[model samples]
Target chain A: MTAYTATVTVRLKRGVLDPEAETTQQALERLGFELSDLRSADRFEVDLDAADADEAADRADEMAERLLANPTIHDYEVAVAER
Target chain B: MTAYTATVTVRLKRGVLDPEAETTQQALERLGFELSDLRSADRFEVDLDAADADEAADRADEMAERLLANPTIHDYEVAVAER
Candidate 1:
């Protein structure tokens, strides 16, 4: 089996409130940096063994769907690479 | 000036503890998924006006350094793209 690293990025769906991003934007403004808006996401990198890249991606997708991401509020994408 | 979006990613420095990632990994294992290790990071996307991409990136870098990231335990990157 080949080893792979799967990267999953999870972001809040459009219209979802992102308080942390908002707070961060405000802090930037206070620091004299100008910005219109801000959004934040969570990125997960998982290392595992699999027969091929596709298998590794499938497993990582399952992980994101089941635990790493909250479906109702999150949108996630997965990318796999040999490790 | 033009509008730009800057992406900043914050990750725990090497040797720092990441309990949340550990918990997520355990939960995945409980669900019958195998993985060697898991790491997580936060990504921020900021939109702002600047004279050019360089200015936007600099402002975003400042944001990451001043508040978006904790230098002691976090490492961040800034990327800028026209919006």
Candidate 2:
């Protein structure tokens, strides 16, 4: 098995209420920064051994679907790389 | 000014304590999944207008440093693309 890093990014789906992002956007505006809109997401990087990158991504996808994200409100993506 | 989207990824600095990541890792273990290490980050996508992509990226970097990330414990990156 080869060492791999699986990255899972979880974000609230469109139309989902994201108070955190709203608060952040407000903070940026308070700081005199210019921007139109802001959204936030969570990223998880898992290190493990797998047969290959595809297998690693599969495992990571399973991980995200099961625990890393809330399907009703969130969308997630997975990427894999050598460790 | 042109429309642009900025992505900022905030992550805990190396050696920083990440209770959230630890908790997520534990949950994965409870589910009988195997892994070595787990790390978590936050990603922000901002949509706005800029003179160019470089200007957008620069503004996003400033956003990360000033409000999006805690410089003491977090590190952030910025990427910009035409919107």
DockQ-based class of model 2: high
Tell me how candidate 2 scores on lDDT: 0.92
lDDT of each: 0.91, 0.92
lDDT per residue for candidate 1 within A1-83, as digits (tens), equals 99999999999999999898788778778887777888999999999999999999999998888988899999999999999
Per-residue lDDT of A8-33 in model 2, one digit per residue for the tens?
Answer: 99999999999999999999999999
Backbone clash count for every predicted candidate, in the order shown: 0, 0
- List the candidate 2 regions with Cα displacement exceeding 4 Å: none
**Model 2: per-residue lDDT, tens digit, B1-83?**
89999999999999999998999999999998999999999899999898889989998999888888899999888888887
The candidate maximizing DockQ is: 2
True-vs-predicted CA distance for residue B6, candidate 2, Å: 0.9
How accurate locally is residue A16 in candidate 1, as Cα lDDT from 0 to 100? Answer: 94
